[model samples]
Target chain A: MPVFGFYKLYLSSDRKYVKKLKNLLGFIPGNLSLYRMAFRHKSIATNVKKGVKNSNERLEFLGDAVLGSVVAEVLFKLYPYKDEGFLTELRSKIVSRVNLNALARKMGFEQLIEYDNRMVSNTRQGSLLGDAFEALIGAVYLDKGYEFTKDFLINHIIKSHIDIHKLEQTETNFKSKLIEWCQRHGKDVSFDLVENQEGESNKLFSVHAIIDGEVMGLGKEFSKKNAEKLSAEKACEALGI
Target chain B: MPVFGFYKLYLSSDRKYVKKLKNLLGFIPGNLSLYRMAFRHKSIATNVKKGVKNSNERLEFLGDAVLGSVVAEVLFKLYPYKDEGFLTELRSKIVSRVNLNALARKMGFEQLIEYDNRMVSNTRQGSLLGDAFEALIGAVYLDKGYEFTKDFLINHIIKSHIDIHKLEQTETNFKSKLIEWCQRHGKDVSFDLVENQEGESNKLFSVHAIIDGEVMGLGKEFSKKNAEKLSAEKACEALGI
Candidate 1:
């Protein structure tokens, strides 16, 4: 296809293009400009003068929160008996990078992204897919409203991807359970730092659990508390306390 | 006060208690059980043999997500330009342990707790405070609905506690900007593992970013990707490309 022909066929905001996109999204009468901006990648440089922002970064920001709120509200209504910790874990899992990327790919967003030659060759598909998915949400919200966005999310995202039964069964209070066990058995549990190695990328903390003056278990984590918990769990298992 | 006198003073479901709680919460009653369940701690061994579940954990779960969604919606409306990372960080700070505990304490929940002698003396204060705060939210939701909860959260939580201006000034996108800079300058940038340590608490990864085969920067984190981003950021600063 000719370069101009590609623009005519793919980038036109005519009835055909709008109709096709509407059919794909399962919604109609959306703002075409917003949808256009949603699909526009940063690599496709705008011809505007300096100081004019070109990318959909701003829209992505709005979209991310919209997505989060919609998903949270749905989960809240669906699982009245589930706790805050479980709801948070479920939300995180649903909105994770891998899940977003999978959704973007499923929607065939690559065909819509307007990237230049250089960016097209890059292997960083993960970031692109994530960005596109967020942008699409922004578009949906702008075209409709909160109610429409909520409906779309419920129908397209939650109902399609998440397993409600599995989410209900996920364990959350391991740390609390461990503490309760220690209290019941009259065992003194303490976590001590074994090492702190600072490197170029991130800080690492190593911790060991001391039970009865013996190093019963060890763990490593990005945060000190997480490491301590891991070590404490190991110690609990080892001592059978 | 005598034990019988104290029981008479404290245990009566007087109009004063109802009026005082209603005034404090700014919510009218219909779902009194939901409110009651919100305040009832699991430690208080209620008559479960008759099938009355004694704890507010389930309510806490519902309230937590409701609080999060409401807060998120308020932030989204207030901060139009803020990104996902910024919003997440701000939400975390707002709903942090210290903040929630302070809120609970301010509401005079410490005196309202009905824990037994054993659990009361223990350091379960943190959990108690957190649960009470969540219960208060559950009460508000039941007394009102989603609209009331949203308004209450905005007025009581966000406006009272969070510093919106400070959050607006925080910067992000360092990693993506660095990549764009490298590509523009026709330089190859790659992150290599410089150190790997496994300790008792968590696994740590240190990474170094090499630009055009020269070590430009180093970074460390619990996760390799995060550490690699830090290394890339350092390289961006060192090279000034």
Candidate 2:
């Protein structure tokens, strides 16, 4: 009877912890176990049962992608006129590792993290904070639906930190700007594949944007166009036309 | 009044197009010019208006991130028990360039694209399809809220094409499986960093899994762990232990 009472008390404590988390997040709890596992760093060496996996690294990975998506979705909705570059810059700013780490610190997640004493130095703390931020995101997505995740991000991250107007203007059309500068002063622009090499892992392409038979820029990247764009930008700077 | 009549017809056609797009996507049209600009390709040379930008590339960039988020969200909900690796693989499968192109093709986006005849071949078609897919996604986000985008993806992409169970089992946690197998079979598993190179573009690492003082497998990747995992898979196959 005493053992049964102890078990009942343990269950109540678990419920209370989950309730506390829900209050902190401003959302209902769906899978508190997942959230707990998510906060458990591998360094802690906790006993994982037969069916369970270890650490929140997996959750962090999932959360990273989820956070990226939710942020992108919000950016899309908020800036209807913004082009891809603008949206990307904004999303990057919002979900940058530094920003995520800051948010994690704000959430008091460092206190909850279960890391080894040896890894408690200043440098490790930052990385752990970043990882915990990602884990929290994973936990959030698991606890609530995507809508809630989006709303949470919008309220917590974007609304508080990001300057939407500045992002919109700065991230606007680089390619167009380059092209316009070229055309306004009567110059022809073309991207030529200078060298294309297939590496052991990824294919690499070196591109040069030839303007009036002069190589304006030279760049290399995994994709031809991306490399070409980099080269084009360099060329734009070089020519000053 | 012929010019006025022409303007009236143009407005009506625009309205009809917007209405059809809204019906398909579920978000009310936010900016007609932005939408129109989103459908434009760089190949379609036109007079540069003062404030107007060319091509859907920027929108495509924004859409790419948005699509990634939406797909991530869908996968998260669909596979609650699945780990991060499983979620990533599924998301990648859904949002990969190949998959996006297929979806774009299904939507009959080729007809809607405003590209030059030179860029309409089979090879260039994939990029076009991919871009259209992104633009469509951007359009959908604008036309519908985040919920609608999530629902559309679930209905159109996940339910229709993706095999959730297969994705969940095959793609993620390969490293974990390897570790478990080693533990069960009483074999020591260790990832030895053979080479770590920080290149200008990417950080490259080579890893070898030394099982019983023998190089069981060796692989190279942008990431050390990823390289180690690849090596581990090879080791598993070679040793047959």
Candidate 3:
């Protein structure tokens, strides 16, 4: 009972944690346990009993939903007459895994999060940071509610970090466009994985977008679809379609 | 501006809408315009010059996010010890197109929703119902805020209609399990569209789950994936894996 009571007090009274969170979140957290859970990765969580849950996973799930809601609302408001598909595509571009990961890293969440050293490396850090960023939103929602969370996302995340204009200009999926173009022109298009080289830990795939028995575009990436997409972008530029 | 002013008064005073909504939601909505928009399908919308927006699509998008948030929160609280993946899979099952469509239809939302009669048929009704359901939830959120929306979902939607226990027991993705089972058993698994018969308006797909060049399961549906899934489910039962 004393240990449980002491833990609660420690969560509220931790000066270093308060300062760190204040710096990270730009405000003092009302409930410290939520924030602590936000930063606590499952890899380093101490197992107490079978039914006991520990880690940011649940919070991450909650935050992801809240974040999606806020983002969808902002997009809906911003693009008044835009169709649902347009809004969905734009939102996807902004909240893409790579985009979120980069944004989280830029916000210094990677440094603030706690995880097992053995579980994390440079290769897997991107996803970790993105998950932590979502978990933070979950914590913020729990501590301050939807309006406060929405304000934070609007002022802090979307406004400061995300460039909607630039993102709009950047075509998120070129391959789909290229395929559509080819279909309209009565041309058959196909992608072939020409090369797959093993990296230190992962395989790199090289693909060629072939059209009418000609290699129209060539691309190389860590994944086959991406490599094909890169080649398709090149093909699109070449064909001006 | 008198017309606009009068419209606002009419929305609040509309006895039929209020009564219907009260019966549906257990409370009167504050913002009737949001609810009106929620039921206002794009096909039935009257044109009011350029740049003016109409229809429930935007609200549907918003409601989708809000619904997702509520569902995630419910799942998170209910399954405290479940991993993120498990929670995600469960949430997906609940919010899935088939599930939502069935739930919406069962709630008699199709009869209440405003849509163009020319644009809808039995074949295209599932998505319409699902979208309307999401839009209704969106309207509820806008009218009553998060707590009220959460309450409506918990009390009205999940409590009365949804059987979480039954849904938990149901394996939503039998195909994935069957594939994994086949892989473990060193059997090649493939789904072949053996029959595709054209109906009056739609095509019916008949798929067979082929295991080691043997037809292990047979299924028929309007869609290929669903047919394959039905077959996969049969396959799972037959193999007892």
Using DockQ as the measure, the top candidate is 3
Q: What share of the true interface contacts does candidate 2 keep?
A: 0.43
Q: What is the DockQ of each candidate?
A: 0.11, 0.19, 0.30
User: Over 4 Å off in model 2, which ranges?
Assistant: A1-31, A45-54, A73-82, A118-122, A161-241, B1-38, B45-54, B77-82, B118-122, B162-241
Q: Cα lDDT for residue B60, model 3?
A: 87
Please write out the lDDT profile of model 3 over residues B1-241, one tens digit for every residue. 6577446656655867778877777887776778888878777877544644578887888899999998998998898787778888889879876678889888877667888878865446557788888988888877688888998899988999898878888976889988987787689999887633212114767778889887777777888889999999888767644
Which regions of candidate 1 are displaced past 4 Å? A1-17, A29-37, A40-66, A69-89, A114-117, A120-123, A138-145, A161-241, B1-18, B45-54, B108-117, B120-127, B138-145, B160-163, B166-241
What TM-score does model 3 achieve against the real structure?
A: 0.71
lDDT of 1 at A112: 73
Ordered from best to worst DockQ, the candidate numbers read 3, 2, 1
lDDT of 3 at B221: 86
Q: How do the residues B86-123 of candidate 2 rate in per-residue lDDT, one tens digit apiece?
A: 67777766676655677667766666677786856544
Displacement of the residue B37 alpha carbon in candidate 1, Å = 2.8
A128-147 per-residue lDDT for model 3 (tens digits): 88888889999999889888
Which number leads on lDDT? 3
Question: Residue B238 in model 2: shift from native, Å?
Answer: 32
Task: Tell me which of candidates 1 and 2 scores higher on TM-score.
Answer: 2
Model 3: per-residue Cα lDDT at residue A69:
89
RMSD of 3: 11.6
